[model samples]
Target: MLYKLNLEHILFLDIETVPQKPNFADLDENTQMMWEQKSQYQRKDEFTPEEFYERAGIWAEFGKIICISVGYFTSKGDSRNFRVTSFYGEELELLKQFKQLLQEHFNQTRHLLCAHNGKEFDFPYIARRMVINGMNLPYKLDLFGKKPWDVPHLDTMELWKFGDYKHFTSLKLLAHVLGIPSPKEDMDGSMVKGVFYEEDDLDRIVSYCELDVVTTAQVFLKLRNEELLSEEEIKKV
Candidate 1:
């Protein structure tokens, strides 16, 4: 079934997020209480809400997207290229730009949004943040009444699971196991919060996000038993 789909119809993407505030104290009293309640199970007695705040970006209610990097395939005769681009800075503005890209270019019954673990994390996170920012959901992100087969989204992690629902795979680990190049040469997801809040390095995060997008595309190609994308075939636009 994967071979039946055109690679050009898929938009591969990855996102980087950070907590809404630099510090736990930066949140209002009510929001802080909400955070404590929301994260209690995960925190247990090992860490306080403040200590667990760095991981708040994992949830849409307490976090904001810092960057969304996307890559799509293009073919010219026998040559194929993957062009990558990113939207970053000012959460609302970037979300608007990403929505515009989906609505204008990728709005079709066949177009798919592909990411690693996208259905569980990236897709819903983007949708929730768009609603929080007062923007209407784009068609691709809006999955209100669509049947499971009608929805056009692909998840590498889900694909890797096959029939095993209990299996969980991180993009980095999957890439390594699949023989795809690692996207975590500089930093991993655990370091994203410090990079954003303390070092103020949006460019670094964008680069990492783009690499993940590229790696995701490569992983998809591998899953389909197709030729892996050479480094020269990837272009940052």
Candidate 2:
């Protein structure tokens, strides 16, 4: 099997999610139940998703997709540029626009969609939401059913499994270990809902998502020997 992906051919992406409401405490019983079940697995710290929703209220009222950010690395005359686009607002319309733009600008034969932890979260979330809105998925998304090695997918979280699944490493920790500065150290996924819904600061969410994709791209470069891995601790993980 060949393992060569043109850095230019890969578009890195990340997304932010929160509930559609203003407060989880204000959520109806059914919505609360839904959040509880989904949160059961997602919550690792002492706070369950329900508890976090009650405390933070971003996810409870914001309705999941606060922002979807995509970044592509472009090189021109020895200059490397990271170009980014962010989709935020009522999910249904923005999602359609995001997909349409991607399809118009990028095709499967040339560009491959990539993301961090995208297989489990970002990709599926986008696909399911697209289906919910009666939209067509991009061509490469259909490749998901094929063997992992055959697909264009490259998830850093899954890559971490090269060491062991026993220890969970976040994008921040991975970046730190690899000596890549995390542009998002000041905030994280947990704060996404609040920063977006409560503060009406969609840009922050977009920035956060963009940083995640950039970090994912950095991680991928290190993995592929396209870039240097600065920290020795990265090998341990």
Candidate 3:
């Protein structure tokens, strides 16, 4: 089987983010200048890490979690499915639940935890949150200094170009190039903070995350030369 399909492991993942809250406070000269020179994309409600922190509901007090979506696929299958979970309320409690789920379903080395830009964002966010909540880092996450190519840590964005480390690719752009349908709806990452603060609806965030995971899985499938799924073969729930 290993020779036939080149299979190795399962994939787990998570995303940490906050809503883009309003910046009604006094804008610094630099910020004001930047806003004045905003591009069409820049005009959209996207927020920087600092902006997300200022107003995101979950991060407002204890930091926001927006959503965490996990995808699992085998080398033999064309379709990869992601089980996206959402967390609301206190950051510490949510972090605890997230840790429990990882421990319950995944064992480091047996399964890999995958993310798009997780090395910089998802994993570190989870680790910091765990420590803040008085919990220890998972063994898999604690394995620092190991090369990513040698370990289960797979970042599709990083792998898309085989670590040339230039020309970052957006998940949506990748899906388009591969003929995979984008899972993201009308809302982009920037609007997440608003959804949390203005809408207070966690389900929206969860659905958005599911879209990201599905897109990620689709990209992975394409890279492995597996058949892509038909619309009927994919199910959100």
Best by TM-score: 1
**Model 3, position 225: C-alpha lDDT score:** 74
- The local lDDT score (0 to 100) that residue 34 gets in candidate 3 is 46
RMSD of each: 0.8, 6.1, 6.6
Where is model 1 more than 4 Å wrong at Cα? Answer: none
Q: Give the Cα error of residue 93 in candidate 2, in Å.
A: 2.1
Sort by lDDT, best first: 1, 2, 3
Over 1-237, each residue of candidate 2 has an lDDT whose tens digit, in order, gives 114666778778888787666676787898788777766655767786666664332332325566777777667786666676778788887887778867887666667778777777777777777776778887666665777656666677777768586756787788788887655356777776667667888776776777676778788776675663233212110
Runs of candidate 2 exceeding 4 Å displacement: 1-3, 36-63, 143-147, 163-167, 228-237
lDDT of each: 0.95, 0.69, 0.61
Which residue pairs in model 3 clash with each other?
19-192, 19-193, 20-193, 58-63, 59-63, 59-64
Number of backbone collisions per candidate, in order? 0, 10, 6
Q: Across residues 4-117, which tens digit of lDDT does each residue of candidate 3 receive?
A: 422235554657476323452345566445444442253346764344334333332234464666655433355443334455456677777667766776665566776777
TM-score of each model, in listed order: 0.98, 0.78, 0.71
Clashing pairs in 2: 17-64, 18-64, 19-59, 19-62, 19-63, 20-61, 20-62, 20-63, 21-61, 22-61
Highest lDDT scorer: 1
